[model samples]
Target chain A: MAHPQPPESDPQSPSAPTAPAKSPRVGLFVTCLVDMFRPSIGFATLKLLEDAGCTVVVPAAQTCCGQPAFNSGDNKDTRAIATQVIEAFEGLDYVVAPSGSCAGMIREHYPELFADDPAMAQRAQHVAKRTYELTSFLVDVLGVTKVDAAMAGTVTYHDSCSGLRELEVKVQPRRLLAGVSGLSLTELPGAEVCCGFGGTFCVKYPEISDKMVTNKAEEIVATGADTLLAGDLGCLLNMAGKLKRLGAETKVRHVAEVLAGMTDTPAIGDPAASLPNKER
Target chain B: MQSTSRNFKDNAHKALNDATLQRALLNVKSGFQENRARTVAGLPEFERLRDAGRDIKNHVLANLDFYLERFEENVTANGGHVHWCRTPAEAREKILEICKRREAKTVTKGKSMVAEEIGLNDYLEENGVEPIETDLGEYIIQLRHEPPSHIIAPAIHVTREQIAVDFRREHSDLDPNRRLEEPRDFTDEARAKLRDKYFAADVGITGANFLIAETGSTVIVTNEGNGDMTQLLGKAHVVIASLEKIVPTLEDASTILRLLARSATGQEMSVYTSFSTGPRRSEDRDGPEEFHVVLLDNGRSAMLGTEFQDMLRCIRCAACMNHCPVYEAVGGHAYGWVYPGPMGSVLTPSLIGVEEAGHLPNASTFCGRCESVCPMRIPLPKMMRHYRQREFEKGLSPQKARAGLSVWSYVATRPKLYRLATRLASGLLGRLGKVKGRLTTLPLAGGWTSVRDMPAPEGKTFHDLYRDRQAAKGGRE
Candidate 1:
């Protein structure tokens, strides 16, 4: 593994104008779901960043993005958790999350949460400007259009609500996926609609959530795709769980796992040996 | 109307199980949304028009008192009566008084959500007056003795087959074996039946799309010509509008009108965009002898300066409900009020107490399709969240939900405890589901597991793995 040069040695730094420009330093906000349920996504994100000639660090103090509290209308606790996140991820060149929902929270909502405290509000605004979803960082900020990875499967992508509406992460992932070899993309009907995994909403109103996810599952299965892919883990989990319950043979995985060519792990919610590695 | 919003969960469950309503709801997903999308695509400046509409409403709201007074002055100058009402009971009483004065045995009515808000028809019927719905959809629902299911399409929950059955049940005077298979057949039969009611009606009641302060004119846009007949053929014409419907001028009204029909029914313009300033003049041909405007406050004045003030900008286009996935799934009646869907989720709690309608705001998935499609650019989800905050502050949210949230927040804010708890839980669950990589049932998560399986965690926390990976890499170069 390659290590990034110290900040003082970077040519872009005012202190050392003669030295070569160092790689961009990125702090990975491995969301809580990814940290526990699927560490493979975090590793995949790290590999993608490293392969793009960037230095990636997983900030140890980061836990969750505080969305679960914020969406539940517990703004007081949300502010405290956001304060901790700001303190941990400060001073990095950029903050990137493999999940758009978390990145959207940091980028779109953190500043709104600190509207009363002007000093904290300013710090939050700074951090918010530097935060980007992984695919967005790769395509929009890093300007990398292609990846050195491939997989053989027909997959449909589900655009999660927060990422699609709040952060506008529609074409970034699709643009990168166009570069992968042997992976055909099928369009899912009503792909932009929510799969009803609204943090606490699924459990709070399970019947409504079940109806919405069932509609989404029928649409996904109608496309006849062998695999399902999305950026956010919450939607992926909700969709995968429903697909499994319906006894569909469709495989589910995070887009990063496929983009980074890490298909050795089993597909989400499937039996351990259900899928064999077929990367070409 | 008596609100059953407190029973939103039960209503939603019943609606989900209702087979006919489920089939009728398919029309909303396929018809209005696709039509609006196509119509909006033809107009490149639809978004800019939305901004204009929002700004116009905001300006009027900022100077609401001024425009309202100006409107009242103009109405009085035009030989019209303006009655200010602060409550539904007052508005209903005022309309009843007008009917009593005119000795109106029957009144023909256009589709008015404000009328529904005040429960005017039932109140009139109880007071020995008959209120006949002139709009085709409203007429069908009236025959069935049901409230309007949708704001624009009042009978969207009723299918043509059901309507035919209703007609056969109610219209025993008609031929018992007549064909009623097509929509045109229903329309022709309804038109013939309502023609007599329009002539017999002593008073007309209709809702205003806009109350123009400049011209003292009340506007009603309808695809059917029934609204024109309802106000024209009757002896008196009455317009029932809420306070927020007052716009500054006709130009402002026209600008908002550009977005209304396209948002509501996806038409460039409705078939009849009729405006009535006052009663008929001495030399006039066909017009009402009296004109009255009942301006109802009905808990709207309190929303003018608060976080919910943006909700007052709604034009009632039904776009929010048309695009809402929740409304699409459960249909409109599940909301259990005159207003339904995303707008109802915010406004129901404001009009009715949040305690009575707490489930309305909590039921959404925050998909944001409503806010995206709203012609007036209302931040509906944000307003819904504000209602949630109110519920949270008042301790009106479910006790179990609040307790779970507090416990989770307590653990989440402390990273060390969170990591330890997650590690132990994931390791245990990982072992329990080592074969399938998913759990068929979870102990405490029955809400999730009852409907769908829960995927097991991948054995260890990323923090634990990363720390070990760093130690193996010689302690982070």
Candidate 2:
């Protein structure tokens, strides 16, 4: 596949500091959760990519990453969705998503799903090799240690299960967050455990899901972090919704919003409650 | 055991509402979980040992026919009898036949899950033979007429407060006002009562942790030493085990032993590790006079070359259940069968037909923690997924769930249709939920809203916004 003529890029924000040059062109796979529930994370991802000196595009043909089907044991559909995604992003130098779950599906499970189809399996393998979660791509591929972004108050980060276990994304986000001025990170107990927002899992087993999220809520509040940030919107929504129902005042937001210095939007599930976070 | 696994949802619901059980579950964190972490960290070779353990089991499973035949020959050479049973009924019949030949009126048990699996206790009692449970946890549960909630910790769901009441009622021979408030007090009374049962029991039955083909020995590892007493004092000793427990050599058993205690209870080693080859020799004193080994296949040999073959490598460590968040919440009874937790999720379907046990495999978040902690490195989540796939393909899953998946799949495979459908659905739900920034109720989403609110979407779809942003750049991909 040949690359399309590259789009001319503009500096995203004048106040932000970035090293400018011709860089790799990336296609952002705005995951199903991000595309539906929260588009702010998608924009935040764009700003981070642009600020990091990469030309990014959004492929319109993409829909779900087929996680809901893959998880439900529908391999035939999983293969179809994966094959479509491979063709959709086949021309890009890198395919990045802000979700570890979606990124993990594409990176880890897609090739296995298409193993019987030799030609399509090779395509899935190629797409998987270049796919990455947002923060991991920035730190790993772009050599980004610090961001020209900052947020106030203490915030605890959650290691979403797929991100931590399959992709090994525990340290990259932390390493980047360490550079954000005025941000103090507290460790969450059982941070590696699932928040029980396993796509269809929360609905299928609500009592079990409630118990898991309640435990997570108590631990998040116990840290007294005042705010919670995670890489995946599915987990953030689950934790944030539970925290709200429990009458806890702890706020929740996607990690990209804080990392891109785009903290003006309201925290998730906070009912238009604005982030008091400002430039440090 | 008969399965109530079909009512898994309701059982989990009740288990969650039981406050006493909830309080007891808190101990799991400070109990097995912490101890296992500490012991594992102390041993740098734990990972290497796990590899060795997995390899030894894999080798035995590949050559299972050879090892079982060799094991039978060796046991016979050591003056023991081996019975090959194909089903649970056959196994129970064999044990009863031996008991009748010995004129056994009472049998002592030492915490065998296989006995529970075969419903051995109730079957024996129905045949006019009394079965006495000597393990403290098993004894507590036996008196309550409850099945073992967990494989290793039989009474994990029962609180000590509940046990105090049970002891006062069951042990009517004891002082009514005795200090039975502590765990040790309960243990002391149980020890006194069971010490009498040991000498009276004509047959003693215990489960095998490993069956060594080379040494003709059946091994059992226990912390309480009840297994030793059960085997030593009875006139006849019977070892009941599944077919997969056999290993080719004693050294292979030793390697797995190094991993078993630590993974199960976080101990450097269990207190009593006994190996019994056969009946007592002519010169030997204080040992059982008759020795018998019952090897029950019961659907296990059929799993030899299947996707579930890895499950046979499990040593019943209980580490998978200890770290599983779902098991941590509802306890083992909710799983509704002999085994529970991640290992049970895979094995239950294989042993007890998938139709009754399909719900067990579906009750997971696929967190991968169980596979991470398994001593044999069994791919538990993958196997559970395999069960789910079988259920789906066989049309055994619910009609609504299958139809929903098909409808969703039909759209998801068609990119243009999927994008348009999502765009319209989000546009409508986003407007309805925008005011409060979350939805308290949703169509077909009662499971989510019954406990917590659903975070609503921002009004516009991401593609609309992204296309506009890229259009302003005079480019579209």
Candidate 3:
């Protein structure tokens, strides 16, 4: 599969020879789902970036990436959301994201979204050029081939559609997973296919989404892997939701959380996890 | 083919519950998907050929009027007639007129999507001309009184048991009790049954895959040889095709043909690739005497120079449908018309207005698999999004969805309100779901939780966590 290495199509491939004189300043685009559902992924991503010598900051003004609006053909809303995002991260040297869906929207769709407005388009193009998915940034820009992380089971990876197709993050996550100690990576059949968590699509067409995830669960179970890992939490939660419903005990976590060796917390969709304190 | 396209949700619901249809769809899911991947992997030049194919179709489209005229001139010179029709009604009437002129009581047909596009079979049957389907897949669906589910495999939704029953009911003259469990058995029976219809029919009706302007030849590729027999045996041969089927030369046709079967069925070449120019010469013994072509425009001309012109490049390979998870789940009948899958989603609304077929485009997950496997590299998901945009702009989408999106857009633009709203919602939902790690159900989210549980959020947002961490590392040198 020629994975676990930067593809030749990387936007930053020309000058990968030497490390920078200063730690690169980064603005983490905490995607809406990660901000709401699983904050551990954000911490794991920040730790990995910091470990790789990045000066990371989370922009306070950041919100959604406008993917839901853009995908549903609400271009007006999409432009507004995109403008807010572009403004929030414009001062940084890099904007990295943990979810492929959000990262891909910035990297691939932002320029197109702002194409008519010349100044906004220029800023968008710059933001897109500087944007990278978390794993791809660590391996491609930071040149970190290995990580100090450990896991106990045979884990299979699901390549979320947006990341694999739009950002070409197929090999980056695989590369990081290979460095985890005591972890055997078994390739899941049809791993590159979607898990039917296409944001609004799952709820819009539940039957079709259910059928797609059901097939995905069957393939996951067939691999006999005890744990499932993927970069995007949307796909992980969708697959995890189905896996738990089907009564399979397979643990599901973001590739970042596992690769950061922070698996002490319960799996993202595990029903057995204890609730947070009410009087914080 | 009546358009129940508007009732797609209902159609899909029925299709999902039909066990027979589900079993029949398995062949399309496994056989076509696996074979196409293997064949595409073997050809390194597949992507290049897709570019070539797209360029050829684009060139023809740019000069479509010129190519059609040149093709007509060539056809006339070759002792053939070309009937240019702007609508399906005109094409059907012209075809019937020619058949009645030849006193054709029976018409043998090769598989043609344009034929389906015009609803030719029902029109002919209503006017007292018998149309006998010659393609194996088309023949099976024809006997069952159904429109084709899949374009290439017309009877993709019909099971072996259903076909056996259909044959036993229709072909009373044949042996009543022969074992019809095997696919080969069904194929043998169809071949034997359709064999006589070819010779007995007075007119042959077939669709052209490509029409060459240089030679005035109409080409059709099929795994079955019935097309050749249909054209040769009948007294008059009628080729019905859309206007976009015209190409400049034979070389362009062959270049596109290289991508055709490999994408359609993963075969290096179809069993038969027949090119007919006019009719047989005076010296020929076994060819039809009259040759005519019906060129139907329908709505293709409207698509040119629009956001949809790229769709003219489609060669009806069905690769997009074969690999689509949505199509695999509910099958082609759910799409509710002549076309299905990613290609159908884009092309249907373009042909039959988006107001009627809005759901087709929205049905996709935008998985990008269709574009990945497409032989012509059609940006299917992008076009589907275009349809959604049009539907939204026209206010054709459901009122509830529009209202929800409006509210979301309003809140999302105001970052403060968006933060406050999400924080409160997440805090309440988090506390509720923290005990269980997931939510079995939630208000207005039953569409999601009806099928699977929704994962609970962590107590704090990433922004909140990041702020806390930064405070702890305050004033770091």
Question: Which candidate leads the pack in lDDT?
Answer: 1
Taken over the whole model, the C-alpha lDDT of each candidate is 0.90, 0.88, 0.87
Clash pairs detected, candidate 3:
none
| TM per candidate, chain B | 0.99, 0.98, 0.98
lDDT of 1 by residue, A1-280 (tens): 1232233322233222332346777789999999989888998998898787677778787889998888878889899999989998877778999998999999989999999999999999988988999988888777777887788879999999888888889999998888889899999989998898988889988999999999999999999999999999999999999999999888899999989988888888866656564322
Model 3 stretches with alpha carbons more than 4 Å out:
A1-20, A271-280, B475-477
User: What DockQ does each candidate score versus the true complex, computed on alpha carbons?
Assistant: 0.71, 0.61, 0.61
Q: Candidate order by lDDT, highest to lowest?
A: 1, 2, 3
Over 4 Å off in model 2, which ranges?
A1-22, A273-280
State the displacement of the C-alpha of residue B418, model 1, in Å, after optimal TM-score superposition: 1.0
TM-score of chain A of 3: 0.90
Best candidate, DockQ: 1
TM-score between model 1 and native: 0.97
